[model samples]
Target: MIDVKQPPYSAVGDGVTDDTQAIQNAINAAQAGEVIMLSSGKYLCGPLVGRSDRPLLLTGTVGAQIIAKPNTRTLLTIRCSASNVFQLEFVGAALTSVQPFLASSCIRVNDGLSGVVIQECKVSQFSGAAIIANASISLRVMNCDMSTGQLCVQAARARNIVLERNTFHDLGQSGFALHGDGIIIRDNVCYRAGPVGGFGAVQAGSKNILITGNHSTDGGGGFELQNENALSATEPSGSSCVVAGNSFTRTFAAGIDLFRSGVVLTGNVFNDCNFAAGLPTAFTVQPGIVPDLAGPGSGYQAGDILTLGGGVFTRPARFVLNAPSPNGGLCDPARPATNGNTYVIDMGDYSVFPTNPANVTGGHGTGGKVIYTNANIKARGSGYKSGDVLRGSTGTSRFPVLVRVNIIDANGAVLEAEILFGGYYTGTLPTEMAFAAYDTVSSGSGFTLLPCFGNRYAMQYSKPSMASGGSILGIGNRNVIVSGNSIVNHSPSHDCGILFVNFLNAPVSRWAITGNVFGTFSKGAIKRYNFGTLSYDTAWGAG
Candidate 1:
């Protein structure tokens, strides 16, 4: 028989007492098959522990409430298996806490638990997940009214979980961020899960999962599944996921985003979701967000996608590699200059004096990136390798922007590295963002050459320059299908609906990209590199 009753537990239910010890006492006293009932009132307290041995069922009425202390862990922790918590309001003290956002959880289910049920509860204002399943198995969060938290439910390294009949609204990140296998997320509704841009309403990186009959309205994206090699351990590459019968509305991003292969997305309603970046398609097998290509632009923020303006995998025009002298001035003349590659300079002094006033934005601090353009002492070698100084000078001052070799124009001499100044760079070494100085265009030589040649054979200044073919693609990835979605609006700031990029040198195979609907895109539907030529495919929503 379960010893179920109120009081004697010292739980006043007064709504204004520190009932931490009293509630803990009740949880401790419960034996196997026993339950503790709370009366109608608020129990302001700290963390509570549930045990697997006693298997306590902590039940509360509609008026019963449990609140976490400000700036602390979750209010309820259930690591023990077969533990059940029901019908209680879990409130986070975000209003009365000092920096509550740092580390706080409403409920956390630690690893190695089984058959844990959290049902019919209300969780609000938590800085972290309302329920986070960390390496736990067989956990069920059903019929819960969860709202106003950072990630309402997160399942990382957990398995065989079911989240159903949950109403999540005004969340901070994702309604559900899952990272496990054999998980089922159904009959869940999320409303503008967050205020700003984020991931999916139900996001994950695992296989054998089914996301069906779930509804979400604008927060970040609708549903995203990525093969994040860095996050997963068992299956680094994602596969065997089924996302169907889900409804999305104006999600501010793609309605369904899948970075893995063989993801079957059918019978999904994407209403105004693919409207992000003015795309008309509701499903994506690649990254749907337009990359933040680095160029002469301002107001850049962190996490912005930086890309080479027109270069990724082409035979980049090599910088003249006479090789820097031991003293850092002109190259050692013993080695001749390569005609097409050598960037010869008429140097008076190889001294680097910090005479230019430049500033870069969107880094560690305001203007932390040192900015430099063309200047005196302007001779540099292009024979790049593991052992090479990108920028060397006679004086103590160093070059501003390094690593970023924004070679402009075609095969011409005399570098005008001023293009590097127009970009916001972030790196460790001082020579990371700095570009070597050169002459201007009117000099019949102010040219932009291929700047990145980190690995090449000993040039002793051998190869002049390289003229070769390039490669681009309309889409990347393999064995994916995109069907039936709506995208009505697109941003005029960009020139595409969906731009596919290839970071790996792998081939794209067996891609069944078709049956997508596009609305108003700035430049047709999709654009990519076709061999060495820039090609545009009119398959806006479908490929």
Candidate 2:
């Protein structure tokens, strides 16, 4: 059975809530399943020593912060044989401890153990790692933030561990790392780590692992998977690993570095890679997300529609559809129903013909607004030009629409004006908000550019539908599609337009890049390469 109770000793500071006695009481009295809750306040105690054989927990008042003095060998040592939990905050002693001897770490999970969980705590500013799970223990650390320490979390020869929803920022070395099995890391945010000493975001060697939904920014390119220092026994180890839906932006090394076998890489975006530009393919691997493009009444049709998650799309034209039957072994059966293909061409622009949905509500539609007309005086301009400003019915004036220019004269003279939509004044020939810059003008057709070796353009908009600072969708285990997002106005120091990399050689196959804007990129946009099985749909600017 599980035990839950409070600590015995309770001591408060004079005019200061002294929690030293309270902590000792809790630790001494805690039974196998009891919890020792620390009151909210500063506990000016010396090093907290854990009682052997007593499964204990040192927690704090929800809002209460705790700090211990320095010179203590270990802060809240764990010698329990059974499963134990240490939640809240526990720090080393300071102030009263000799100078140059402040404190080492906030906590330590010591000696052979199993089923240990350390969660929801803020541990940092220590000389060593925030928490060190010494050799031979299985641990689960979830929803915690570790920063400013030599190392955030380190486990030597651990197993069955999971680290999820945690944040590691501004550290000297790796974020969270372990040597174990059944490890899964998801939805965590790591930034500005490594480059101080020799550090990577995550470095681990585990079997049957799943690392998904995480974002690593700046510093190192992202993750590294290595064989543990211990010699192998040839025991069918470190196989079946899946890494997906993670974003690595402005990284120095490759987005993900793999050193072993049987891993899969899909739907992970890498933007503005520094140390390792594009993907570096190595080892036995597979690319999980690839597009199956069969055309014109063939591949994916109306009935083939799937649910679409939100994200940025660089190319906006090439849509993926299914072809006629006999299509058995072509597509991966594990493809999720939520995948959709993206293309360039402003297919939603009304100037071409019938109006598409302007603002779709409910029933899963593009939740963004599209505004373009024949003229501003009549409604809105259907055309575009450089420097065109848009004046809405409401008193707000918008851009790229208001800066329209009429025919370029022989002498390079450009005529500028505020135009209306639909109808024009007599002999005035009112221009639309949209206008293609190059000389080629084709009526009834949206702007199309002949393929040029290297071309560049600029656009401005409010914001993208995806979250400002997070990954939108994850691609895992082969066969996927990323489509339809109008990305714009990206700030510097930001990486990615649409990223593709495979850690397990699950080389992304048959990918279709469509319908997304790449606005103001200091680095070149749409970076793609491979790390695993050499197969995938490789198309850039697919309009």
Best by TM-score: 1
449-506: candidate 1 lDDT, tens digit per residue: 2222110111221111111100001123456554554434434533433444332342
C-alpha RMSD for every candidate:
20.2, 24.1
Model 2 scores a C-alpha lDDT of: 0.42
Worst 10 residues of 2 by lDDT: 453-462
10 residues in a row with least lDDT, candidate 1:
284-293
| Candidate 1 accuracy as TM-score | 0.59
Task: Give Cα-based local distance difference scores for all models.
Answer: 0.48, 0.42
Off-target runs (Cα >4 Å) in candidate 2 are: 1-8, 13-22, 81-87, 91-103, 196-205, 228-238, 275-543
- Model 2 misses residue 237 by how many Å? 3.8
